[model samples]
Every structure is written in structure tokens, then in C-alpha cells.
Target: MCGIVGFSGKESKEILKRMNDEIFHRGPDEEGFYQDKYVNLASRRLSIIDVLSGKQPIHNETKSIWLVWNGEIYNFKELRNELLKKGHKFYTDHSDSETIVHLYEEYGIDFINKINGMFAIALWDSKNKELILIRDRMGQKPLFYSFVNNEIIFSSEIKGILKYPYYKKEPNFEALNHYFTFKNIPAPFTPFKNIYSLFPGEVLIFDVEKKKKKQFKYWEIDFLKTNNDNIEEITYNIRNLLEDSVKKRMISDVPIGAYLSGGLDSSSVVSIMSKYSNSKIKTFSLGYTTFLEHKNQDIIAARKISNILDTDHYEYFMSPQELIDDLPNVLRSFDAPFSGAISTFFLTKLISKHVKVALSGDGADELFGSYLAPRLSQPLYYFEKIYKKIKSGYQLSNEDKIKLKPFENNIKFLENLYLKSNGNFEKWKYEILLFKDEEKKRLLNNGVFEYDKFNSFDLLKKDVENLKALDPLNRALELEWKTLLPDHVLAFVDFLSMVHSVEVRSPFLDYRLVEYVASLPGNLKIKNGNIKDILKKSLKGILPDKIINRKKEGFVLPVFWWLKNELKSFIFENLNEHELKNSVFNYEYVKFLLDSYYNNKENDFKLAAKIWNIVSFKIWWDLYFK
Candidate 1:
């Protein structure tokens, strides 16, 4: 799976083949290039591993280090046997992009701390003319750079750095006010204007003869560190680090499968990929034709775990007019304006017609305690242990009504999580925002929120104010691994599964199983109220207690009963007010969120998620700057 692009100043090599033909559907099998006089590099190859001489910008032997990767490093044959026992000269008999230019010729930019997977790389050295770039460490591949004039560029989608030619399209508007308060757009921000987002375990570097650049962070997932172990040794070390991250993502060459949405994170990743496959294991699930197979319990619990794991199963339903007729191919396969999980782009376009790698349980609910803002993390430490047992009035049971069921009947949302949660992260950032901040100050149009901090929960409010000493369920699972598990669920599952080129591998994003379920103790990743109760005791007896206690099944979409029946004139023909008049929304507050979503009458689903998040930001502002 590849699709990289390059640049590093004095452009022209025909703008790197028009920036590698704008991500040719993220690598249409093969493509490569590498330039000199300080970097040009390119790649598009989607021929999984070593597909006959695994080519790319790959280099080393006197080639002064060149590279081009996109992803899939599942420990490249144990980093090519420790870079072929340090001798380090290999071509391609088995290439993980040739152990990253011989581990950057023996750890020079500290070879991204001995590589794990999900990459973005670029490499290029031209003998220290520099030009690194990286992303992985569980941001699951997405690079996008810029720096202009004094050149930088980089790619792997932002339409391959908008084919540079002295690029200048401009739109950021503080990343569209954090995409209407984080429906997506929270990374090193980029809805254009000097493109950014190198984030996720970053690396930058640059310096093409001191035009300079540095950037940092080698890796993260701290969650205010705490591990005393024992819950049977953290569920036997989280089922032996998620079965060695699903056997190193089944180290692919081609067909692989497992998006089994029968809950419990892809049914414990298809029951450890049907106990390490040898056959009959292809599984996939999706259902919706407007619910009612008991709200189509996620394809009836994935066709009852495909008849209790006998395997080879498939299901499809969709229809809300084929999800509003695949809204312009799932909102133009996102360059931005993706409101995460749009049926993971029709279940990775039906697992790219049956597999080119799938396996995803996507970071087991931001590394445990499946969201309710991380099971409303120790709200006042379980509201002062049930407020000192009703202030010595004792006798409250059923585990004190399951620790007062997340502040039962919301007494002003538990008095704003008991007087605005400690060191106030604005009530756990308004319980994981989906648009607030007084409704994005009554639907934007307030002159580009003064060009910056328009309170999109103060963009991770200074990393949730330096995790204020953890235990608010590891500070809401370390601010959901810094903003919704890597800028909106691994950036819409790596831009909707490589825009249908398909290659989604998240063995619960193994950064050593997210640093051992983020060092355990968030009272065993949610207890009493039982949200991801330590990943259901690490799948007790390898599943089957009704699939390890089901229930955290999100990905439900009916869109508030199709915005008041059959996509109500297809959501006011892409949100009216004459196509958002002079753009930047506020059509009398999108007509008061479409008249309180069709005069209420019930089922609001957060006002159909803010009128389909402003009709998917006016179909991605009429598909990139109307």
C-alpha cells in the first residue's frame, strides 16, 4: 500500500509527475521515481510486500539514501534480520523498502525508534542534503507537508500536496473552525493554507542546505503512566499484546480479511483471525436498510459471528437510497470534511471486493473504556466514592446503583460534572464535542474566528492541560490519544481505506498494544459501569459469552430517520439558504438546525449530528473551495 509524493525546493522534474498523478487512487499497483540535487522522490506501488523486486524510490548502496514508502512495515522481517546482521547491503529479495535505507544507514534520525508500522516516510538524503518526513507510530499513515518557496512539499494525500507549482490555494479558516468543532480536522491542522499535518509520532527534519526544519516527537501514548499490573497481570499482558498484533498484520502479499463488525472490536479481530487462518476465514459485515433486525444489530451481530466462526461470511444492507446515493463517492473520498466512519466508505467498498488486507478493530475504543468520554472518567473519582456513601447514610447497593449510573438523570449533567470537572477540561471537553462552543458561536461566519483559536475545544486544550495527573480514566484515555484517536479515528481509517485501494490493519493500533493498554489502571479501563471493562477481561475465554458481552456497537446511521424521512429533499438539496449564500455558514443558524430538526417530534441524534455536520460542510465546500 503506497502513494507518496515529494519535493524539496527548486521544483521541476515536472512537479514530480504532477505530484505523482494526484495519488493515483493511492498506488494503482506500481510507480516510482527519485531525483537528485536534493530530493524529488515519488511512489505509488500498492503491490503489498515484495511483489517481485519490491520497488520504489528504494535505495542505499552508494545511492546516498533515498526512499518513498506509504505503509505496512509490520516489522519488515524483523527489520531485515537486524539489517542483515549490520552488513546492510540488500536489494529486494524481501523489501520493507529495504529496511528503511539500511535503518537510515544505522540509526541517524534514530531510525524512527526501531520502526513498528503504519508509515508515511519519504527519507531522501542526497548525502545529508537532508529531507526526512515520517508519520506512523499509530497515526496510521498520513503525511501532507508544505513549507513552500524554501521548498518541502511531501504527500500521501492532500491531493498529493495539491500538485505544487508554487502552490497557494488558501482555505484553512482555522481549519474551518476545527471542522465545526471536531467532526474531523484536528491534527497539525490543514484544510489548505500552507498545508500541514505531519503529526502522529512525527519526524520532519528537512534542511536542504540549511533552508532548515526540525520537528520532533518520536512516539507517545503516555496516559499519565501507571501500571501495577495484576488483573491477572493486565489480562495476561493484553492477550499477549493482541496476539502479537494479529500475527504482525498477517504479513500480507495479497488477500486478507476481517472487518467483522459484530462489535467487541471487530469480534476480537475475527476471533484472532479465526485462530491464525489456514482457510475458510473471510468475514465482513454491514447492515442498515433502516435498521429493525432489532436495529439490525450490526448485521445481526455479524450474522451471529458468522454462524459461530465457521467463517466465510458476508452481509450488506445500506439503503437510505444507498446511503443517499454514495454522496458524491463518500464526500469525494476526503481531503478534509470527513465526519469519520462514513460506513468506512461502504465497508472499504465491500472489503475491496473481498480483500487486499482488512483486519481492523481500530484501537480498541481509544485504548480501552469505550467512549462516554472514556466512561465519564472518574467523575470526581466516582463522585467521591458515591459521596462518602451518601454522607454516612450508607446502604446503597447494586454496586451503589452502578456508581450512580453516569450521574443518573443528569442533574444539570451532574452539575456540570460536579462543578466543571477538576482543573476543568470544560466538562471533559464538553463530553467529546460534536459541535459546541455555543454552537460554534451560532454557526461560524464571524470572520474566520479571528483567524485562530475559535475554541474547537481549544484544540486539545494544551493537551488537556498536561493530563493533570491522570486517573480521570487516564485523563479521558489521554485525550483520546490526543484528539479522537489520531485526528478522527486514524484519519478516517487512513482516508477511507486508501480511497478504496483498501489496506486497513489496526491490531488495536499496536504501539506495543498502545503501550500496554496505556499502562493499565483506569480502574482496569472502566469498571463498575462496565465500559470496556478491561476489554471485557481481555475477551474471557477467547469470546462467546454472547461475544464477550457485546454492547459498544456504534457506526449506526439512519441520519435522524433520514433527516425527517428519506433524506428530506436530500437534506435541503445540500443545505439551502441559497447554497450557503456567501459560504462560511450561519443561514439563520442553518435555519435553527433545520427548525430544531423538523420540529423535533423526538429522535434528535444530536440534531442529526448538526444537520449532517452542515451537509458535510456543504459537500466539502462544493468539493474544495466552492
Candidate 2:
């Protein structure tokens, strides 16, 4: 719940202060600074754990090691008790982050292994003349660093590093290309060259004397299935682990609330919170003012859950025009190009008004197989069987061929069992893509020299190649758990929530719970069209039947409808032909998408997603680059 900025080079307290000032919203309660011959560290504190005495740049008993941490270590109390037994003295009882410094003194760099929580830690070892940066195992908190000009600069947010006078504002087109493809530029790759985000469970140590840096991985999810897959035992274990995770996350001196979206995930969290709390729990939700037809049901569902739990519930309704008005601030808040903004931005803003910390249901979808990939695989499996029979001898009528349209164009792809069965890694990578390869070639300007050696798919390919799961569903889930959930979902949540000085905790992201779920067989998660089947069974009587069975409507905005109706003029103004011509996209192709949408020729929601991608990127490019 704070921001940290530090450097292992020429020390300047003023420059460090400027970097710290950029993220004041992250920690407005107080600020701290520490400087030595080799390192300068600055921090802004939000005072979540130890309100009066908890501060940053906290040191161990000897004061040889200083730590600026940007998250809550849920297991800090337990660690503190252990350290006390070992004769470690503590100066303050108000801070959980202080344990980090003592742990470092006791165990050195391996101290990261002794704690469990979301954190981005910058530790300076005066004795060793080195600076170490660590990101939590789940990637719940972000840490960005740059090794340039014979120095290493690191910060909780990228903007902090950019504040360094030596760093210039230059775009990383390779990252932009990857962003366009994945809807997000994955970790270790930001939208800027020579600057990188530390991957989850990653550690970077920089030696100031040698001017050298080395990175290593300390943890990753093991996707290996456990043979003890007794359904009852597994379901009971999931329930127990999730409850313990929620209880651990509720450790705070300040008030905490839940984001009750009424979706299965959020609803489950709220239900669990109500079970554990004697007082009424505060829950928040958001809906669109325009698309009542699509959103009203979710709102009603949220109200029903609130009433059943007897919680203090708050709801906010936002219009499409409000989203258009807030576009500039939204784009600026994210340090990088992020496409999933509308609902996430507004939801965080709405909740921040009432609570400083809120729990969300982010990791459930990836961990429990609740996304489209799992649900689609079941139908696609049958489709694969039908396609094989068709190829063997079945003949289709001309009308049938016409009905298939473009899918008919790639008959080989259709006939490929792996593609249909979710075994084709490349096909899954491109599934629901914002733009296809030819479309990218058409959109990007020829002058925009593609980075000669970097393939946009290298990260995706590496993730695919490393899948150890024998089950196609587990493999897909593992890929997303590794890449999408942490990079896209957690990244946006952290940046946007921090923008309002709000801290968001995700019980679903608990490492113990995640590892257990990852070890379960894929069938337990998704079976016969039931997504999160095991989760539902575990919470069978705990949650309201309506909530447990309700279709997943994740913080969904009415973007498709808005693009067609209320925001049409805004889209035209932002995505004009002149804008496209001036940038890396083809003006003709941009015009065609708008024309098709307006003329009602290609009004598919997928097309709407593409238009949004272009519009959002255009705004981001102009804001950052111009």
C-alpha cells in the first residue's frame, strides 16, 4: 500500500524525492527517504498495518540494511514471533514491513522465501554494496527497474523511473507490437526500451561496485496433477484454504470492504467474508447507466447477495459519456498501454470513495478454470469429432458452406483436432485476438521498422513450450495463470487502485490456494460445460443458489453497445483518418472498420473490441509520446 523509488548510482535526494512525488496517491499518509554513498531510497506510506509508527526505509537492529516495501506481508506477525525467539529486537509494533529488514539480516537474500504476501521490495545492503529488488510470488505488486548509464534505477511504478533526468521518453515499438497482440505487453517488457518490469517471483541483485546486475526466479506454479484426487477431499481442502486465505487478508488496522460484483467469484468472496465477520461487511459494485438490459440483472443479483448477507452495499451507475470524459485520466494513470480500462477504472474509483482497502475476486477465474477457454473447450471437443467425420466423407450443401462463412476458408484449421480441442498452442494464442497477422501488417506503417530479432510470440511460445500438464484444459489454464492473470488482470488492478490510493487484496490469489488448485485435475475445475465446477460444489450451500449458478458477468462494461451508440461521435473524433495516417496504422483499414460498424455490415462485438484497441492506443500514444 505504498510506492518506493531508489537508485544504486549517484545519490541525489532531490531526484529521489521527485520520483517519490509521482506516486503520492499510492501513499499520501507520509513519506520517507534514506541515502548512503551507494544508494538513495524514497517511499510514500499509506499506513495500512501500523498507522502511527509504520514508515518506510525501516531498518534492522544494526541499521546496516534498510528496506522500502510496497505491500502487506500477511505472515509478518508469525515471522516476527519466530525472529523474536531468535533474539531479534524490534523497534516498532506498528509496521508489518519492518520484519523484512530483520529477516534479511537473519537469512540474507533468501529472506524473500520466508514471507507470504503481495510486495515489491527494494532492499539496500550497505555491507554488501548491493541493491536487491523482489516482486511477490503471485505478481500482486509491480516493480519496474532500468539498468542504464552505469546505474540501476528501480521504482514501484514505471513513471517513477522515467522521472530520472537521464532517462528519455522513447517508445519501445517491440513492446507496442506485443501490446497490440496480447492486449498487454507482458512482464520484463514495458512500452519503453531499456526499462523492464520484474516478473512474478523474480529477484534482481545489482552490485554498485561492479556495475553489474543479475536476475533469478525464486518461484512458479507447479502444474503437476496430484494423484490423490478424491473429489470430496479436494473440494473440502479448497474451502478450507480459501477461508484461511480470506482471514489472513483481513488482517489490517483499517476498515476493509469487498468488491461484490455478484459474479460467482466476487459473490463467493463476499459470502465467505460474511461468514467470518460478526459485523456487517461493506460491499461495493458498479453498473452501466446506459445498458440497463445487460447490467440490471447483475445489479439485482448484487443487491440480493447484499441483503442475504445483511452487508452495507453501495452501487454506482456510470454512463458512457462519463467514460469518455474520464478517458484522459484513465490513460495517464496506467504507466503502460492497457486496453481493459472502462469498467476496472470506474469500479476502483467508485470503491475508493468509501474504503481505502478492498478485496477482489481476480485470481479465481484463472485458478478455477472459469473463463471462456475452459467453457469453449467442451463444445469445441465435439466440434472436432464432427469435423473429422465431415472430412471422412460427409458432404455439405452450398447454403451450409455459405453459413460457415470465413471458417470455411480455413478448412484445414477446422479439421485439425488439436486446434478444436484447445491443444494448438498457436491457435489459443491467437484466439479472440484483437487483430490477426495480416491485419497487423495492414495497420502498422511499413516505416515502423519491426524490431529485427524479437518475435512478438516469443513470450507466448515460451509459456506454451513450458506447459507440463497432460490435460489440454490444464495447459491452457497454466498459460493464463503464468501470463494473463498476473500481467493483465493484476497489473491493471494495482495501477488503477493505487491511482486513488486504494489498496486491493485478492484472497483468490493466495499462493497456497493457487498451488492447491493448480495441482487438482482439470476435470475438477471444468467438467461437461460446468466451469469452476469444483468451486461451485464446494460452496454449494454456503452461497445463495442464485449467485452460485449465475452466469459470470465480470466487471463488464457496455463497450460494444456504447461504441455503436452513445460513444460513436467520441470514437470518430479520436480515431479519425488523419490520426491513423499520422501514426503506425493504415488510414484505409481504420476507416473500413468504422464504415463497417456504422453501415451495419460488420457490427460484431469482436470488431468493437478491435476499434476500442485502436482508440485506446491512439489516446495512450498521443498522451505519452506527443
Say which candidate scores most in lDDT: 2
Model 2: which ten-residue window has the lowest total lDDT?
399-408
| C-alpha TM-score for every candidate | 0.34, 0.94
For each candidate, C-alpha RMSD in Å? 22.2, 3.9
In model 1, how large is the Cα lDDT of residue 611? 82
Q: Which numbered prediction scores highest in TM-score against the true structure?
A: 2
* Model 1 lowest lDDT segment of ten: 447-456
lDDT of 1 by residue, 288-392 (tens): 766555457777878888788888987766778887777766666667776556778776787888777788888888878677776666654666556545557
Total backbone collisions for each predicted model: 0, 1
TM-score for candidate 1: 0.34
RMSD of 2: 3.9
lDDT of 2 by residue, 500-607 (tens): 889999998888898889888877787655678899998888897778888776786778777888889999997887666667677788888888878885568877
